[model samples]
Target: MNSARCILSENDCKIFQTITDEWHNSINIEECFLTWESKSKCKAQSKTSFLHTLCFHIRGLGLRWGEVLLLTLNGKFDVITLLETGKFCKSTITNAFPDYNIFYQKGGNPHGGVLILIKQYIRVSRIQRDV
Candidate 1:
């Protein structure tokens, strides 16, 4: 049986170091992405694709995930794309791909903000903090 109060000793670190060293030098971007997906247990392929799109837009244009997800379809262009390209047209927020759902805070709520699903797992710390 495993114990919860287990302390990671130096021997544990040595083993972890050896395991990490095996993949540290050869890991590529695609492999890193796959590893993240596997560790996150985000099995829904649509969710993974959403995260990839979100990460790319976040890194490329420095926009928050909430901003990207809550973008309205009626707008002329997505703010991030427009700000980057200086052109405005019908937004693609709803078209092209509709498999993913956008999360946002509705009016008449105490906490006013959008929620973006960046990962598949919720941290215990977050649950404690919320309560």
Candidate 2:
């Protein structure tokens, strides 16, 4: 086997080339190189063969919970984890996403909390821990 690096353009994108020999000693080369022309095509091909899962981690969901929910709905996230929720009541958080199942851990302080929300259609289990 032999390998070499080729630079595509002014941006200096690199593509690796590999050469292999068959049992008959004939050099057989495959499409191991990702040239600029094929880079976008490869990415398009990958999207169809891949599963798209979106997860979002939000730092603050206190006053911005509505905005966060809007973003989540637009993005169609599979899971969302929120930190510093600034919420003490479980009903308040649960009411935000009626379509999803919510698990929450309230922090010692009024300004710190964590919540995890997953779509109702997804199968998930919650494990509770005291720390």
Top TM-score hit:
2
Which tens-of-lDDT digit does each residue in 22-49 have in candidate 1? 4575467678567756756856654653
lDDT of 2 by residue, 1-131 (tens): 12232334423333222122222343322333433337678888888743234444445566676777687768766677777776545687677678888877777776677777777888988887675
- What are the clashing pairs of model 1? none
TM-score of structure candidate 1:
0.18
Candidate 2 positional error at 107, Å = 0.9
- Cα miss at 45, model 2 (Å)? 9.9
What TM-score against the true fold does each predicted structure earn?
0.18, 0.49
**Deviating ranges (above 4 Å) for candidate 1:** 1-8, 11-15, 25-27, 42-131
Global CA lDDT of candidate 1, please? 0.38
Position 51, candidate 1: lDDT = 17
